[model samples]
Target: MAGISGLKVIVKKNKMKIVVLISILVLSVSCRNKEIKSVEKIDTSKETEEIISENKSKPDTSYTTDIPHIEDFQNEVMKEEDILFNGRLKKYFTLSEFETVFGQNDSIKLLLEEEPCYTIFENKDGSVDPEDKYLYKEGSRFENSKDKVAVDEFKFTKSNFVLFKGIRLDSSTSISDLQKIFPNATKNIGSMDVYKEGKVQVIQLREDENNVSDGHINIFIKNGKLYSMHWWYPC
Candidate 1:
């Protein structure tokens, strides 16, 4: 009887030990699952932070702005036309074959009579014969000289005239145009940047029709107004 009792106690103790082992197994599985969940959360947080940091490192450079209108440019062109026709301007120019790039002003007149020369000596080369005895218009020179003006001083700097190819200009053209028109004369224009003298402007041309010129000529501006001009011809 005592042996049977002892066996029963051992069975009970074994049962208790089995129950504790199962509980420990279950607790360990739960803890491992919790650890996996924590690892996932940590990885997700690190990914989010990396994305935010990349965004912060990059800069946004978007370009969105309207261009400028050309009203002032148009007004300047009209003023140039007036000066071209007026007796005041005294610059030289030949026909401008180069068309306007902006579709602003396209048609310009090519007039030989505009020069007002009575006799033009035919030379073989592209040059003028100042002392050609065959062509003499003294009266034209005298009358144009009566309409002359002196030049006033303006602030001057280096010239950028090498950029242009011809003497003619449009409203879209700037002092840069003038600089490029005549490389040879641009150097001669010691003051350089003509526009530096805000007072000076390229208005009309004054010329001596009979004097014989090949290319452009220079005229002076004074005060606000332009007087007569002094160019051999061609401006």
Candidate 2:
């Protein structure tokens, strides 16, 4: 062995080596912890994105899905509505009763029995025609296309209507307007049969067998509102 001073120097060198090893170990542990944190953040971000995507893909839960198809759902709704809304006890009537429901004289003009009847539909913007606006085309029979009747009336021989409007609710309308038109009609029976004119309201009668119904009326609905009414006329 060497002198005591030599021994002290060797001890000092051994301690320095141990300190370096400890520092290297601490740095490795810190790097491992940082990598773990990065992985956790990535997983959380991916999970959040998946949740958002799932929410967007889901459809409405409130609508009925028990039916096999969309049409089945509609049929079920109509059947349910008929049961709930129909309250008429008068099933069938004689020709006199038919005349009683419909007026004795001509009230509604049957202008377009061959083609579609014309009626002016209020524009959707709910804007009434401007007072100064005149619908016309230069040297044309129709002043303007917009000036023409906006509504078309059709006579239905069947109980069901499958008509649809792409950009508009063609069958949708307010019941208030019908009420105002037909003050005599206090309630709806089997079909949509309400009409309004000054003080006299005409009833539109619809029948499954063409103007002969003692029970059931069919109402037309569109755009979440009542469009038209019809019940059978006893013939």
Candidate 2 lDDT at 218 equals 42
Kindly report which residue stretches of model 2 are placed more than 4 angstroms away from their true locations once superposed.
60-235
lDDT of candidate 2 over 97-137, digit per residue (tens) = 32343224222232232122221332566333432121211
Predicted candidate 1 versus true structure: per-residue lDDT over 124-150, tens digit per residue: 564334332211121012121112211
Predictions: Cα RMSD each: 15.2, 18.7
Per-model lDDT: 0.36, 0.37
Q: Report clashes for each candidate as comma-separated counts.
A: 15, 15
